[model samples]
Target chain A: MILTVTLNTALDLTYRVPALTPHTTHRVTDVVERPGGKGLNVARVLAALGHETVVTGFAGGPTGEVLRALLTPLPVRDALVPTAGATRRTVAVADRATGDTTQFNEPGPHICPAEWAAFLDSYETLLGQADAVALCGSLPPGIHVGAYAELIRRSRAAGVPVLLDTSGEPLRRGIAARPDLIKPNADELAQLTGAREPLRATRDARRRGAHAVAASLGADGVLAATPDGTWQATPPAPVRGNPTGAGDSAVAGLLSGLVEDLPWPQRLARAVALATATVLAPAAGEFDAGAYEELLPRVQVATA
Target chain B: MILTVTLNTALDLTYRVPALTPHTTHRVTDVVERPGGKGLNVARVLAALGHETVVTGFAGGPTGEVLRALLTPLPVRDALVPTAGATRRTVAVADRATGDTTQFNEPGPHICPAEWAAFLDSYETLLGQADAVALCGSLPPGIHVGAYAELIRRSRAAGVPVLLDTSGEPLRRGIAARPDLIKPNADELAQLTGAREPLRATRDARRRGAHAVAASLGADGVLAATPDGTWQATPPAPVRGNPTGAGDSAVAGLLSGLVEDLPWPQRLARAVALATATVLAPAAGEFDAGAYEELLPRVQVATA
Candidate 1:
């Protein structure tokens, strides 16, 4: 089973507004809530692809309860470690006319030292049963930025191929422990490597000790570099849509491919197809099965 | 004990950011949540003033649970009628640089006939033991605009004064029930009475069956028009601050004055003091005791 850990979980809410004007009041026409965090998003896509997945994270209070309740209907197992602080909420305001979005993100709950110790115990127990692990999202307050690095090292000791998907100082520190894979978007990659070019950034990320570096280049597609070689797989064409969770879908594709031992070319192809499909889907991190099938064979995988 | 009924309760969340740029992502520096509805705001203020308050209305689903959880630590008692749909959430983006605020309001849960009846039953039971009832905020989905009218009529029958605080269709319908007191901001009074002049509008509102219309004139102070006469109560000068929930605080002031058996002029004076205090206080619907004391007695009341 694939285990995903989200240290900071959120109740993601979407609001559809005709327009978003700053310093003004707006009445949202519709609203939807989702179980959200980078790891949760990855787990959701994996589950949708028929992978056995377990989601373990720190969740507490009412927002945590709602997150758990929302997950009950999904095809994912949850073993959330309870804490005292309420989970954070992320809000997205979609403008119907201009098709733009305004996002407001709340930093997740603060975790005391005792809570972190409890999470470590829970993680160690879950790692023993899981074949692979994916650690994602920002670390909450009171937890050190090197927290992901410690978890990565623990997962490695268990002989599990860990996938680390995060940004900023967490990613910088986590890369030193050399997780099996690290996924960073172009902007994040540039920040981490000081390389504006995707290929240069991916190579720099690999040198930083990540065994494999997958750089997401929004419309251009995924640029992946490993010890074996480098490859760039571009989708059939850019499909214009809300591309909020496309990167996470690509992570799911890459991780699921690794789990199945698929060839890197095939893995790149799958990742591109999934990322493109995610954009076509109306909601975040969702894709149409039919579109995914059509795009899979058309994805071009070439040496980087 | 004071009973505050919030027909459309919300999970009120505030996000603080350095600046706000539309269609872009923002990293909120701080987050705060509170149980919000007009009556809930009133209850919070009253609770801070050491009043034993009971908050009742329709609260349901996960959001409702979160709302209840947030209010648990407060001094107010919650006795919400459960329903199938989740309660709404309100998000506000406060820009630290400009100190501007952008608000997004969600449509609240839909109340079924059974739930509506349940709410009525609960409200009546609570009113039987209360000094007064404050029916505030917008009507929820599937509930009639005249819902406040029914409650006002019932409160009168129970020999309890009702403070009806709402606007638009609900306010229009509710005024016909002749609530003992109705508080309308200048804009609301304008909408209800269509008089450009504040005094004329308050008089017109009183003529339309509101026993009295406490018209909030923003920085200009509050004008109270009773069946017998009209009086304008102005604080020494405008208290400088963000006046978000000043109106709700005014309602609290009026209720507090009525409970203390203050005459109309004295009540107006207290309201101006409290409203000014609320404007000075950092929290919505709350006034610091020091501010209230300093502002009171300094307010000048002129009767016509």
Candidate 2:
């Protein structure tokens, strides 16, 4: 089973309004809530793809309870640790008139030292039974920047392949632990390696310690610089839709391919296909099965 | 004990941001949540005034749990009924830069017939011990528009004074039940009575079956048309801060005076003073005690 960790879980709330105006009152016609965070999103897409996935993270307080309740219906297993601070909520206001969305993200609850220690213990245990682990999303407050690095080291000790997907200091620190793979979008890759070019940035990122670097070029798709070789995957055409959870879907695709022993080219092809499919989906973290099936064979991956 | 019924209770979330722009993302700097609705707001103000208050409403799902947890520290007794649907949330985005607020209010959970019956049963039991009951807020979906009318009748049957605080159809139907008092702001009064003048609107409202009518004239204070006499209470000067809960504080003041058997003029003065004090407070449902005390004697309530 693939294990995904989301330290900063959120109760994602979507409010549908007729219109959105600043400094005015809006009566939301509908509300939809779901469990959210990068890893959870990845787990959801993996579960949809018939992969067994376990989600572990800090889910506490009332929002955590709501998130857990929403997760109960999903196929993924829940191993979320309880914390003192209530989980945060992210509100996305969808304007029905203009088809625009305004998002308000609340900083998650602060995790105390004891809570972090407890999470470490729980995470280590989950890592031991996992075939592969994906560390996702931003580190919540009270967690050190080296948290991903510590987790990557623990995963290495457990003899499991680890995929680190994050940005800024966490990504930089986690890469130093030499995780099997790291997925950084164009901006994050540039910020980390200060390389204006994706190819150079991917190589710089790998030199920092990662065995492989996958750079997502948005509409262009995935570019991988692995120990085996370098390959660039491109979609059939640009897919325009809400791109909120497209990257998470790509990570799930890559992780699924890794566990299935697919070649780097085939994996990149699947990642690109899934990312495009996710972009076509109505909401974040969800992809249309038909779209994924249709686009799977159409993606092109070539040696760079 | 005073019983406050908030049929449509909400988890009131306040998000503080530097500025607000439509269709963009906002990182909320601070989050403050409290159990809220018209009745809950009134109950909070009453609790602060050292009154023994009981709050009853439909509070179910995770947001309800969060609202309940927040209410635990307050002096009000929780007698909320459980429902199948999750409670709603009302988000207020306070722009620190412009001092403007954008509000998004979720339509509350649908209350099925069984849930409504359960709430009524609970309400009657509470009314047996209540000296006065305030029926507040809108009716959630699946509940009848005459809900307040039914509740007001029940409170009268139990020999308890009832204050109906709402607007539109529910308020119109509730007034027909001859509630002990009805407090309508300028807009709501004009909507209900079709009278632009406060005195004419208050008189029309009382004729519609409310035993007494109290009109909140915003910064001008409260005007009361009661069985005793008609009086207009004006503050020393217009107090300004957050007027979110100023009306609720006025309701609390009126209820407190009613229970204490204060004369109509004294009650109007107290309500006006408390309303002004609440406007000076930093947050909703909170009043400056010092300001309330200082303004009480200074408020002018003359026969009109």
In terms of TM-score, which candidate is strongest?
A: 1
For model 1, the stretches where C-alpha displacement exceeds 4 angstroms are B47-52
- Model 1 interface CAPRI class: high
Q: Please report how far candidate 1 places residue A293 from its true position, in Å.
A: 0.3
In angstroms, give how far residue A221 of model 1 lies from its true place: 0.4
Error of 2 at B134 (Å): 1.2
Instruction: Give the per-residue Cα lDDT of candidate 2 at A16.
Output: 93
lDDT, model 1? 0.89
Worst 10 residues of 2 chain A by lDDT: A280-289
Tens-digit lDDT track of model 2 for B93-202 = 99997668899999999999999999989898898899999988888999999999998888898899999999999999999999999999999999998999889989
Please state the Cα-based DockQ of model 2 relative to the true two-chain complex: 0.80
User: A136-235 in candidate 1: lDDT tens per residue?
Assistant: 8889888999999999999999999999999999999999999999989998999999999889889999999999998889889999998779999999
TM-score of each: 0.96, 0.95
Q: Give the interface-residue alpha carbon RMSD of model 2.
A: 0.7
- Please name the candidate that would achieve the greatest lDDT relative to the true structure: 2
